[model samples]
Target chain A: MPQEASPHIVRSYEGELRRLREMIARMGGLAERQVADSAQALIRRDTDLAAEVVRRDAELDQMEREVEQFCVRLLALRQPMAADLRLIIAAMKISSDLERIGDYARNGAKRAIVVAQQSLISSLNGFERMSELVQENLRSAIDALVEEDAEKADEVWRSDEPIDGIYNGIFRELLTFMMEDPRNITAATHLLFIAKNMERIGDHATNIAERVHFVVRGEQVTADRPKGDDSASAVAGAPR
Target chain B: MPQEASPHIVRSYEGELRRLREMIARMGGLAERQVADSAQALIRRDTDLAAEVVRRDAELDQMEREVEQFCVRLLALRQPMAADLRLIIAAMKISSDLERIGDYARNGAKRAIVVAQQSLISSLNGFERMSELVQENLRSAIDALVEEDAEKADEVWRSDEPIDGIYNGIFRELLTFMMEDPRNITAATHLLFIAKNMERIGDHATNIAERVHFVVRGEQVTADRPKGDDSASAVAGAPR
Candidate 1:
């Protein structure tokens, strides 16, 4: 009799895990769209679309909160071990990153709204290309996660380096525009925020890839891209 | 026969959990010192010091990996329940945030190195103050986490608003400097990066606060003031 009851509890635990997976996928899809729309609004200078992007970020945040709550509750109640516990925790971390990505998109969209109104906004200079890359990277990272595909995750991680180069190019171009004339400052600042948002989206994509690696092999793959040095002590003697 | 050994396994699992706690505390201390040093580097423009900061970042990243691995191993072996599972997951997340915070400091110090060559580059307003606030918030948030104090976590959350405001102020100032003169672009770019890094540190601190709330109360807390609601429709539109 006791054995039967314990198995029933385990089965219910499995049910909760399934539900959690569904919630994460839902959140991922919405987050991906927010990035796409935010980019489209910027290129098109459609304030209405940008405003919409801003509004949707709140729901992403709320959904993320809900999913995290569900996962933690399941862990507390069921006491999943090994792969199951890892799955729930990975979901929590992944959702948090996605929510932040949504926030970035909304922030970019807000800037797009302001820049769209200006009379002298400069050319975005391959920004649309960069935005598309970011969107694709994000979409694929989530796909890799759900499928537990390590190759796809690695691809997503590699995608971030190129995205960073593009961001640097964009940054320099914007700096030049602002230097050329004062009228460019406002729109340029907004554009810069959008670019930063795109770069951050890339970062989140990398985070998802790392999570995918963790889920698949039960080992951390973040060690692949090694940071150069500590650079911690360099702060004290530098000019403030 | 089995009854005699059950208590031993339980006891060993508890010991492993305690060890995790100690590791988390050590990681927290390392991260807090990084923040402090980054601020000092910003104030001093010390290139050597900045280099050290960058060096320390890798160590923190390594520590993060180790912490994550330990958490995984524990989860796999112990199948802990309720508060114990919550604690482990929180530790995993908190260490990730700590590593990222270390990154922010390294990035900041790198910028300080670039700015070190320039003559007295601190003209950008609000950065020094933002740095101090971020550093203080990080210290307090880590303290709260180590001590398991919810009220401290709340204070960290509330403090993020002011940090955001200061970051905005720094952004605007840097934009003005770049707008005013073409020659300042390179150095100002470094300064802008420094500002972004500080803002990121603030974000990391907020993340810790959220984890603390999740660990202690099994509920989610808003890490910052809520933005626009339009994010709702956007979030709702995605396929679940």
Candidate 2:
């Protein structure tokens, strides 16, 4: 097991690690909320909520900057080794991923603004379902990071397959909808991009999971990443 | 000006920085080749080449690991200050971006394999153009890193507008083709994703540019990012 720091101090090596964890936890909370709110905004066509998501992304970005500076200072002053070093590095990477998750959420919200201006489609359901899974994976990934639980991280890694499956279904369905009417093309395409963003968010969550596994295990995760992306397997012209 | 290492030794701090730069350069070269080859495979419908791009992604992933390890080692050993520190962190970020670009290329190749089995679209010329631009920007971004030329990086950052414009144009053209014929949806959709990937590659390049600026200036690039994404501005409902 790795040596984890106590969360109750602020001066020594352990205190720094504790602060790092806290910053990451805070960033993760903000990121998770962004994902949830962005999805909710898209589903309800709540442009105001989407705008709020866009505006709040700056907070995550600021948190990322702070985490980076803190990690650098810790690395510089503490010159930690072994698990502590790994933990610090993991903190940097996880913060980057969470910041990116924020960007994806912001991008989704931006698309939501455009999407809301268009006529509605029933297919936002796919987005909602996909975001739910992504949000769950993201929360779990962050929890794993905080708890340093490789098993929880592994579970999140494995859970990406279902999200990919849902994405593929959404991909084909969106194309069909676009083909049915050009009017649906704009909204459908926006939805496609939103789904793609969620898919990427899921990928980043898995990335965090892998990082968590690495920090705890002191080695890279060697298992093949599970993939269920069948959306591009066959051309529409090819025999199924 | 920041102190640069003579690329001749390994036992000194500057030598470590030089080695880090060399690794990043090599990784950047591999990533660039992957992008070029993936686009080539798509254009020629050469599944073998596409497969090669997918296979070669492992090299970039391995390179990313090496770079990460090297950076962490340098940090733990040297505790570099100012430019050196920024450069190391930038290397980590750049490698991650390069790895992601490689993944996008591999994804494009995978889609190209399926696209090969289907009917071809002349609109692929747009993809060719977009990839060329992205490759150019990526090359310039890396060069900016090597030369520590923030001006060049800012230029590359500005250069993304044309790429986005091309992407938007392709988005519309592909949507038009798909709207005209349901049979075109599958291939056009794949092309759309490829275009989006290229757009994202361009974004990554700009991200590198910003990092370059940051590393050289010791501060974040404060200017607003230049964005000309017309993809969401108007629906396909507008007159061609």
Second chain of candidate 1: TM-score? 0.87
Clashing pairs in 2: none
Candidate 1 residue-wise lDDT, A140-185, digit = tens: 8778777778789888877677777777667766766766766676
lDDT (Cα, tens digit) per residue for candidate 2, span A1-240: 986765543356676798798899899999999999999999999999999999999999899999999987887677788899899888988998999899889988999998999888665777888999999999999899899899999999999999998998887777767767777877887888888899999999999999999999999999899988776563543332
The TM-score of predicted model 2 comes to 0.92
Error in Å for residue B45 of model 1? 1.3
Q: Estimate each model's TM-score.
A: 0.85, 0.92
Per-residue lDDT of model 2, residues B1-240, tens digit only: 986875543457777788898898889889889999999999999999999999999999999999999998887777777788889988998999999999999988988998887787655788888899999999998988888898999999889999999998888888777777777777877888888888988898898889899988888888788998867544664674
Q: In order, what is each prediction's RMSD in angstroms?
A: 6.5, 4.7
Q: Which stretches of candidate 2 lie over 4 Å from their true place?
A: A1-11, A237-240, B1-11
lDDT of 1 by residue, B1-240 (tens): 455667788788888987888888788888888877877777876678878888988889889889888987777667677778888888988898998889778777877776777666446447778877887888777777767788898888888877777766666566566667656655765676677777878888888887887777867774455321221121111232
CAPRI verdict (incorrect, acceptable, medium, high) for model 1: acceptable
